[model samples]
Target: MSFRHLPSRALIASVLATVMVSFALRGQDLREADAQAMSQEAYEALQRGNAALAVREYRQLLEAHPEMVAARANLATALVSLGRFDEAIAQYQMALKEEPDNSSLRFNLALACFRKGDYLQAAQRFGTIHNGEPNNVRIATLLANCELHLRQVAQAIALLKPLEKSHPNNLDLEWILGMALIRAAHPREGLERVQKVADRGYKAEAYELAAVVYMGLTDFDKARSDAEAAIRIDPHASNAYLTLAMLDGYSGDENGAAEEYEKALKANPQNLQARTQLGIIFYNQRKLDDARQQFNEALALNPRSLLTLYELARVERAQEHLGTAVKDLESCVHEDPQWLPPHIELAALYYILKRPQEGAKEKAIVQRLMAEKQQHGPEPSVTGSLPPSP
Candidate 1:
């Protein structure tokens, strides 16, 4: 009668049926004991942070009692704790089917979707939850994050503004709102919001954000000061160094920018932004070897990054390695066909290499993409260069 003896699903179902029926007909507490014990064991495993064990126990319980919403919910939670987002999503869906009105189960499902990088589904689910509970700050924040990932900047800002008003001085909300505003092209307003946070004692992150805004505004001196202040507050803040490097590049101080980028990388070696920007600075300086090294490292980190590929191609072209440049540009174009810059560059390279037919093909694509871009308004500049002075 050991629980482990019930190996097959049919066996588990038969045993569960017998246990329930015997308990009901005989009014005997003994028949119900095994079922309660298994549930308690699952709870205890979860309490002890053994998510794998908890998942196993919950799954066993679920197989025996497929209609038990609590068991499904707990299994979903255990799967989430184990970083099994797809499985968690399935379990949560099952729990929701059993209890359609369960807000927590729906939220968990949305969270799993978000974690799995399905921003569209996450946004839809979070939007539904937000509609049901408009005052839920957590849901609003998560929904805004999904919107941001989907490049719905205006919608993110709209969602965050009310939360900012209701929860004044809340650092996370203010920070997100400020970033949303900046992304929405309201840098002045964003800077003011970030400045307010900094003045209110969130100096480190606030200063770093303000520095980025100042850099976008082309106020190099102010950007430098704010970035320095961020570094002073937290020397290991990789973003502060990266910002300083970008400001230096904008100010035509390539050497200083390179040094700052190195510092940023030292603080956090995985910072692809710092690596990419440093490569751009080196490329601009005509230091092809240095630029190639940085871009190659960045490409290793993010193989499909079109910007890195383009920059790497540029370096190869500068070094008169036309073949390598063509290969890189081909890869870049393959990754993003509508990207006009790579097509433009590739056309020129083809013409230079005496490949007139290939050149003409790329030129045609360039014209089409340019026309499409004009019809849709200008694409956002992803060149990582500083904005022109006003």
Candidate 2:
């Protein structure tokens, strides 16, 4: 998802519009001819798509007339266009101190934070603006998306339901609301909303979302059908292929699963699930070198991925690289303290390395997790018996 979708408008255009509006000089007493010339040059640089030049000119302009609020705001916009979000944020903050009531500055600030992956901060900024301008659909939508990213499914659902009710047939809202509902374990209602988008020409994304819901329901046939529809709409629908591959694996057709995973990678080489699962297949077949290669490639794609780290540690352990495996597993354990798989594997590795005390501690945690699972009773897992071929 964005930083995933808006109300069917290009975000870049919005950014440009903000910049154009903020380029108006507020006529400060200190605004001299040199400062004006620099501002004009920076504006032209941006108009000509020379973002680096724009940044340079803006910085120079600000150095001369530090109190020029328009220059500061434009500098932030220029920095944002150059993908220097932290610099943009700093500029926005400084500009806000001068004109604290400027909603446009706050809006741009929220967007910069979103681009920087600070969803919580973005949510806070957007929330404040939304509160003041209760009818601003864009800020409301953005706030809902931030909630979605933070896994605040209940809040996202609550925020979106009224929006969808008021703004009937907004596919973007429907898509976002459907995601929240599905995450809240209301698959049927989510499927209904997503299907509306599919019927209205947002076929690929809608069908892909539907396939995920069906997969969760363990309705492999419907999942495959929806996934195939998505791929037909857009052959680059990597997640659809990923769902298909997962279905194939669950069906016990290893060769089919591998082929589907490869198809997924061909569609999107950076797909983490496809590469990781394919590596697990290789590991199960005892192709240690191939598995190791895949896991390493997966990690290279995203070093912060705890799943990939855990999987790579498993391969290292299988290859008898005990010490290397321990380092990776320990990192995983530190990052994902509540996850049972990493803890379980780390416990085994500790015992293998003859760290009996640490191993016993990990074993105790695993025992506690098992006890919790038992108390919760059996949750529905792989809800269907069979995965049919597409």
Candidate 3:
């Protein structure tokens, strides 16, 4: 879930272009003299970080000589630099049409798709490249990331397994593979992978991931230890304290949970999850004012957050602000119609407000959602929900 440690696709593309430009152009048919000169100027603009100028020049060159594959490819890279992913995708596709076997074109196309949030297409393209070049660890890693986002955990694990064997020291591979395993309900395997990374000197992020894996396995003591290790390695890691706080809450230690949550917020004030969890603790303890403060702060950070709205509604209801609570609940339900808890809560509130028909409608939705949950298995707890007591 954390790509923070990985080199960005843009950086990867730039490096690839630098290393492979000559190879990519080798044996290609020559463009006209004017087109070739314009392409060189565009490439120089790109090198100078003048992405907009590069894009304009490339577009003009492509307009004059649409068959110029290198110019089209360079245009795609410039568009990518500008964050114009859809435009970049178009240019890459056009370039690929001229040279379908070109690996660099295919890779850049896949990266453009990924940036556009078209993960399915990106995965398919990356998979095609991987099939042809299995030793390309970067492509494999990116393909695994696409699988993780698509929730194809088994596929991600399968994709990374052999690579992890060949490149045992790749901490990013281990981190992503561990997370995929955890999401696939193989927490023990995930824990082993993360712990191995931690033992290999990637203590901070590795221990943080290990703590989350332990929490998934319901090994609170181990989770606490890993969290503490993560904190000791990097005190500014807000996730470490958040994991510790979650462990504290699960163990019925509200005070300890609150303390850790506060520490987490202090470490990273923008940690919305920590603030939301702390608010839930306050709500459970009947500290309505304290709960509202945390929830309001979270709402200020993300005004459209459904969990914050739902929690803030609870606070408003506890304080007898019926109108405000109703408004908040209505907004929550509107934001996520299939969320069962809000429907149930809204139904009760509607009944109290003498809106019998609306209450009945909400209650029916709750029944349908509950039946669906029964078929699928238990729903995962959302933010602002209390942890099950130990």
Structural similarity to truth (TM-score) of each candidate: 0.71, 0.71, 0.67
Error of 2 at 210 (Å): 2.4
- Model 1: lDDT equals 0.85
lDDT of 3 by residue, 1-390 (tens): 997899999999999997787655652434456677898899999999999999999999988888889888999999998999999998898888889889899899999998888899999999999999889888998899898888888899999998888898887788778878777768788778879888787578788777776777677788889889988889998888999888888778999999999999999998888999899999999999999999999999989889888999988888988788988999888888888888888898889889999999998999999999999998675322211110
Off by over 4 Å in 3: 1-45, 48-50, 60-67, 134-137, 162-164, 198-206, 218-222, 228-236, 248-256, 262-270, 284-287, 297-310, 323-390
Cα error of candidate 3 at position 141, Å: 3.3
Higher-scoring candidate on TM-score, 1 or 3: 1
Q: After superposition, how far is residue 86 of candidate 3 from its true place, in Å?
A: 1.2
lDDT at 312 for candidate 2? 86
lDDT of 2 by residue, 1-390 (tens): 674455546777898788776665544423666677789999999889898999899888888878989889988988988888999999999999999998889999999999888999999999999889877667777888899888887988888787787887777788777777777778899788887878786679788878877888878898999999999999999888888888888889988988889998999999877898899999898888988888899989989989888988998999899999999989998987877898899999999999999999999999998898899887677532211111
Once model 2 is optimally superposed onto the true structure by TM-score, how far is the C-alpha of residue 380 displaced, in angstroms?
Answer: 2.0
Which pairs in model 3 have colliding backbones?
none
